[model samples]
Target chain A: MSTVLTQRMIELQGLTKRYGDTLAVDDLTFDITPGCVTGFLGPNGAGKTTTMRMILGLDAPTRGTALVDGKSYRDHRFPLHEIGALLDAKALHGGRRAFDHLLCLAQSNGIGRRRVTTVLEQVGLADVARKRAGTFSLGMGQRLGIAGALLGDPAVLMFDEPVNGLDPEGIVWIRTLLRQLASEGRTVFVSSHLMTEMAMTADRLIVVGRGKLIADATVDEFTSQGEHWIAVQSSNPAALAAILTDAGATVQKVDDSQQVRGLKPIEIGDLALGAGIAIYGLTEQRATLEEVFFGLTGDSVEYHGMLGSQNGQAA
Target chain B: MSIADTAHTTPARTERLAVTNHAVPTQSALRAALVSEWTKLRSVRSTVWALILTSAFTIGLGTLFCWAYLNRRERRGDSIRSLLFDPTARSLNGVVLAQLAVGVLGVLVMSSEYTTGMIRTSLAAVPNRTVFLAAKTIVLGMVSLVVGMVSVFVAFFVGQAVLDRDGLGTSLSATGVLRAVLGAGLYLTLIALFGLALGTIVRRTPGAIAALFGIVLILPLIAQAFPEPWDVRIGRLAPFNAGQAMFSVRYDPDLLTPTQGIFVFLAWIVASYLVAMVMLSRRDA
Candidate 1:
């Protein structure tokens, strides 16, 4: 309960990183405000993890600064007592027992033994704590890593792809834990390739593509923008377009067929029925962050067309 | 900056221990880092075997070398006292390789963090870079000390046993014997520190190990192959060959003596460690 809290928890101001000729993080600037689960969302190579590394002071920024609580991570005397992170869950000594690994980390931060056990219990790993980490399943490792992150009860926390190998139950557990940590006035910034997971867990989303910030807004706001569109289908496509146009809605042709981009699905459906357009198929379409992503990402041709996506996961 | 901190300063010296006030400025952070690293060391079973193997190899080689070299050098000398052995020098012959083992282990203890991306977690937990590196140096240095002592002592006993067979001995009371033993331990410690520096610089286990071999093994070998003046010139600069003088019992006026060689070894260790700190500060882990 005595979690030492710091206000500006984590901040990145115009952070940039380059590996030889390639820039991995490009002039990225964002702040992880306290008391919320700010979801760091991106496609492969979007620099979420790179930003995390810079924040932790593991990577020296090429251009700008990454600060934790208004100071650099290097300035903190007892950093673990203030912040915790699971940058990579598998970044562990696989041969050591879960208990020993957590205990050692705890000892480094001057956290007591009782708190180790408590964190283990909280992460539902108390029984498996004695088991060597190598034998644990990936989900178990993620849990153990999360347990380690909580060992210090720091006011700020970060996790990079924490659910990569986790099961549904483990994912739920982490989502709840992250939300709970934030509720206790801790800053929680988590990065994930799983957009759907972030949609569910993160109150706010910071979207990036091609190592640049695409959007930083509430989840609700992102989802709201895409809700006005309707997918219309009919044999008399031109007739339908004409009617929709007459209704003061914008329409475009997609794939030499028909593209409709205005009004609710129900309104379109009613209009189509009344106009005897003989609809083949009709569905409501929301311009989700996913769709906005598609629209914005398709334009990111510099990397896609020039170099081709090269990480294990393709663009 | 606070009045509170000033007021809490220690008063005039007293017999009673003032653990809180008199502790080193960065000791707690250093201690925390040591604890973290020690945990990491024990978590891997390979560390135990590495220590055991180093000691066994050093002792076995020292004994073998002592048996062969002693029998040949003192075979016909009949002063009786002339055969008195230097247990210290004979015992430390294995350190040449044993130090490599401790050095490799020290390198892995750190560089592996970078190779595997665990450095992110480690640095995030303990963000003060200088304090973190200082703690690593202290803890790893201490481990190397203890391991080096055990290996050197074991080599001494085994070598002593072999010399006993020939009734040829090296005097443990000799002027340089104690210094050699201490030097052997100090040498191993320096090697470990050098390994740590290499680890920080290369941030790759294989690269660091290769660099170590190049510095400690190749430089000396390449130096010897050169013509006289070049050999002497390069030999003076290469670290281990110069540092090895510390463990020798006999003084050679033609070469730098054991005592003088120590300063070079220290210079190498200090320079490398400082370079490591610089690279560590600037590089992306």
Candidate 2:
């Protein structure tokens, strides 16, 4: 198990991809180790797909190298056994049957027909194996894509936006499958723009913005990094804000409520009592992962919708 | 069933683990790619339809042309025999239309991958571009060769049966008759490869098909607009005219000899294929 774990690591060293003047994937460096589902978190156009394509050798990086088990993906004679990737679920011939699609991929890697059948059954697509892939729903297409990935029983798996079109049930199925793959000491690297989804599935998070690595930490560490504050409402909000400020806690007034950071709920209550303020509400609010992601990537977002009118209303 | 149910109930996981423990036997990448390419070619409906059209047009049209020739000979008497009588070329005239069907099949072999976005999946599985393209070439070439041979031979035999009614049919033992029949199949196979090369270079169905038509059908007509000797010279060099020269036994001052025709036609295919190989390797999938 330990040997397999070590052999399944994916290493990207100063990997960069530039499309003419635009840098799609900057000089990002990271190692995805086995036994965990590492969520590649990035906003749209943040280069997550570009990075995955480079790792799979589907696209050449402008600089640096992406290695699977310390060798370039192209150098491996049978790369499917080393790593399986589902970069785009729809990147298949629609005219082909589901079974034939997987079979062709399997045969290319010297994988047997039996393994193709096994993966079809595993992905719950055995019933629709004979149907043309064009006839499948988006979720069924996702399943067929996954079955192609699992055809060789590879040690490392990479999925790009795997849950995009999945139903709730399909989403749960993939999350469990990713965890099971990792628990068996395999490397599982999945990309998503949704932080909440990552929070549920990923053990570690590799967050990127504008092709730059923002954070690489465990999920617990990342969540803990978000600001935790106590929301306080009082009759004398100004007095409560002044007292909280004096007590070394940063206080911001939002409407009639004072948001207090660097102080616990118990400490805020004591401060209010000492100040003789009538406290109406005191509730602790930890920033959700979604907010943290937005905060980290706000400046790096490529496109922003017009929200000037809504901003004045909030103010 | 839920993932958990499948995970625990099925022995797939344990079997996979055991399979991974054993060292996989090393197979040649080219061989694996060949098997994969064959599977891809056979699984698609277009391949079947194109081959059927190829055979149908070749045999059906060949018979129709032969019957028409016998009727014309009957009306004109033996006076037309004093001119240029190449019954073999007459019976195999269907290759003119059949080339388009086979060429389209060849174009789809390469261009459809790009149009369908299957190139990414295919390249991911077989990262070696040279091996992947080589395997495709071998499969397409072989399939086209076999289909071309079968179609042309059946067309020859069936058309001869129709032409025999007027005593105008040529036997295989006759001078240049067997070579003409066999050369027709080789000509179609080369055209298929030519279309594949064009498809790979263009990487689009409509663009590649248009380019193929420009070279095979329109080029000869365009050459005719040129003046005198140059017109005949350029016309002989056109891919379709050059291919026609291969199967035409009757000597004509305008058309190239069979040896010159094959060499010139092959040069076109080889040049296009080289450009395709360069683009395929340099460009990102």
Candidate 3:
């Protein structure tokens, strides 16, 4: 019966998961801290879900243990009261009414019926309280899920893509909900594929790429870590890459552009002006979370599309 | 939280699990789980159809079949006249069909959580995943057993009346008549539990149904097609053949014996349940 703060923390030490021969999670070691919304983030197939599964004791970690509130999730006498999670929003039985679906879960956790009514109202499902769950919209289901997560009002709350299917309004609702939970001194961890969404919601980013922990830092720290961040709209990016490289500043190839590493604006302008590559436009760019995520995960993304659907490869 | 996002991400200062020991809710954990499950079951419109259909099919069809059989039997005179008519089989005629209903019912009880992706929500509420699973099985067992038994009883009286019209029936005093009819209720209850066991093991609708049917119907069909000695032996081990043995007035020497049949049936149920429990223990929600 330890508080989440006094507990040993939700630690993953040298965790690895292998399916047949392929490694799904490779030597993952990170602590999801209390009182902050730690974004359990990665592009598709980066093993974010796999890692979460390990923490919850859903997937066996081949190498080490993932302690949730000092003990494994299974070891907790009342795991529900300790940590609440939303792995998938639509995991409810379609035939069940939202009320019934929540009721079953409430009963299992030993919550009262009045609490069920309270949650239904909290999630804004009170209007359709008696309706079957199968008929609910995606946003409605997400709301119901959020209500269930709040039912135990646990200390540690984890959400895997809680906004995946929500509309704009639902999205805003989740953002506020997560922020509120964290502010209330509860640990809130959420995983998402969208960097934009995470940018606005998560306080810390645990970026994973190709089953490896690529970056685990605050947004400022992550962006600042990469020295090579440049925004240039030029007629000659090829010539720019050469000019920036020759000046002793390592130029990293970015999408349809180039990043001048270890160089200030004056240094880049001096090199570009001397090299006869007339830069139509050159702007100093502070690293954004998106740039850092894409830069770190560019090579490992399974698919890339024009829309934010995929990261680097075509389907 | 980060100091830079100044918009949202704030430096994370670690904290306690909200309040304290006295902060725990008044109701216990298990009671809450049961309440949630009850709400889940009654809230669904399909639950009503699923339960009602099983009883009506088993009982109603049982009476109709008995009436038809009696009419045919009256046309011909046969020794052991009363024994020739097995009200047990007639009363339990709907068992096969109702089993499918409850089987789908049971499969959905678990697999639907996976299908709809609700297991995460369920687990989040009650983080002890096995406790969530156990609570579900308990609910399923309670409802299905009650319905299965009730359906069997209704089927018995209705079928008896129809058979009596053709002068081929006797009162409950008839030798094995009462035992057969009542045994059928037990049989349906077991079948529903069998479905629960299969649901836990297979964890999918098609897979669970196919597996249940394969053991109950397909394996028997395949075993019967076998040439000789191996045929009778393998057929007897199959679940349906063994479990259905009690329904017969006189045991078929070619098939599994009465006591052996029950043992075999019980063995299949126990083995499935154990496998399910072991599997449930290892997997994360």
Candidate 4:
């Protein structure tokens, strides 16, 4: 939507939540800025949803605060107008029609019925608006949830696992919707455990592991944090390995090829040329976002397979 | 349509919606909350079905009882009016069953959200727990009041019609008759409110229903097991027994006055509601 950008920023300051002895979120502090989609990334049980809940004031933090546009989310006079969140797609009265469900939330904020209809139409649920939410498939339910969040036309939107059960079309639809909302200059904060999902949809990402902030950077920067290595296939593997190691590069040798870190492909090519060894093939490999995610969150995973490596290696 | 087309059309639609700002008046939080809660209560099947059941039982059973009583008395060639036979109480006998339906409705009003995990959505909308709860109480209480009054009055009229066939019916102008009928309605509404409060405290449908039944039905039965003055004292103090005193046609020296009984029930409702609100604010959704 073409509109004036409302500068709303959500800031979490040392937010911590503990249930008895178990810490759900620990010392989380970050700012979600407007005009872009900021992905909240974490493995399951790493407190992404808990942090979102605290932001929406659904859960009280044990220590610290979640502020929206400088004040607590609950402190806003028109909270729905300031921030709209879909904490759970299925969190609705199943017996009520989808239209009535959004209407209920809309009326709470004194929003008009016309806005409800518009939102239902926007979510492509206008045809089945009268159907009970209980009968809706997961994708339809997710759309209904989005309809509720947009009921007030809030400047800030938060969605938790918006693509969880969506079909591919639904997934693409929400991705475009999130980007559209951000383009309208509204802050869009989406939470997901899938790194590739965030990589495709979010410009900036705030990643967490075991309730602690791991990285807060743009997608470009995040993916770049993954180890970049040059793979070299040489006529003389032994000479190339020595040359790379002597040049302060960590080298790992596999069959017929050497993985060299801390050296550019051009440097390796030059070193091979000086060593008088023919470079049969040379390639620079960058770690994928998925690999980066596994590397960052590997240690904090609540469950692990017996076959998985403990040193952050991809299984 | 292409993704580009969907994207192209969305902004125009958003702008159209954004143009008409409903201009919601800056009223008290409770006013907005009340509107929200009224929408929540009415848009569900449970409320409609429960009220229907309450009406059916209260009127149907009362009519049956009145007819049965008139038939039996006529066969014996005896007068229906007697010192021991409180016709008002007999005509309103259906309330004992009807109250359960009202109680279930009240409990479901709060507990259904818990079961469906909608409390998170609700609390996020209205973060002030006190205002949110007060609005719920007012909406449910108002609905229950209307339903209770309509159902009980219908039962009374139907029951009296049955008794009228035998020329032994009492009119609303008769001594204590109007009070008993109105009191029955008030009693039903109060009991439902009590259930709503218990539901909030328990946060589960079955648990709330069990606790409500314990207070409204089981406790009175347990009180009857005592002897002499203890039985009378405990029974008079129990929730259902004390509330029932409001609708009794005959005066009992052992029980509370109608006003006192209402106040006692009110105390129970207020206390439970406050505790529920306190616990609601204290706990995470």
Model 1 Cα lDDT, one tens digit per residue, A1-315: 223344746878898988888788888888888878999988777888888888888888888898887888888766766678888777876777888888877777766689788877766677777888877777777777887887766677889988786656667767777777776677889998677889878999888876788889889888885646556668788888989999989998776456677677777878888988787777666676667656655654344545435544454
lDDT of 2 by residue, A1-315 (tens): 223334567999999999988898899999998878999998888999999999989899999999998899889888888888998888999999989999999999999999888888878778778989877787778888888888777888999999997777778878888888887778899999999999999999999988999999999998788988888888898888788888899998877677888888888888888879878999888899998889888887765564664342211
- Retained true contacts (fraction), each candidate: 0.37, 0.43, 0.51, 0.34
At residue A254, give the lDDT of candidate 2: 79
Question: Can you tell me which runs of candidate 1 are displaced by over 4 Å?
Answer: A1-8, A230-285, A301-315, B1-27, B69-74, B77-87, B164-167
> What ordering of candidates by TM-score runs from best to worst?
2, 4, 1, 3
- Tell how far residue A195 is off in model 1, in angstroms: 2.8
> Which lDDT values do the candidates have, in the order given?
0.75, 0.86, 0.72, 0.84
Question: TM-scores of all models?
Answer: 0.84, 0.92, 0.80, 0.92
Model 1 interface root-mean-square deviation: 15.8
User: Residue A167 error for model 2, in Å?
Assistant: 1.6
Q: Over the stretch B1-285, how does candidate 4's per-residue lDDT look in tens digits?
A: 222222322322355322222333477778887888898888998899999988888899989999998767444644544545667877888999999999999899889889998888888878888887888888988998999889888888889888889776787888888998899999888888888888899999999999998988888789889998898888888887777778877777777888888888888888998899888988888
iRMS values in order, in angstroms? 15.8, 4.3, 8.2, 5.3
Q: Write the per-residue lDDT of candidate 3 for residues A171-278, one digit (tens) a residue.
A: 777888788777767788899888888888888989887788888998667767754455665667788777777777777667766666677877777777777777
lDDT of 3 at B173: 72
TM-score of chain A of each: 0.84, 0.90, 0.79, 0.91
Weakest 10 consecutive residues of candidate 3 chain A by summed lDDT: A1-10
Q: What is the TM-score of chain B in candidate 4?
A: 0.88
The number of the candidate with the highest lDDT is 2
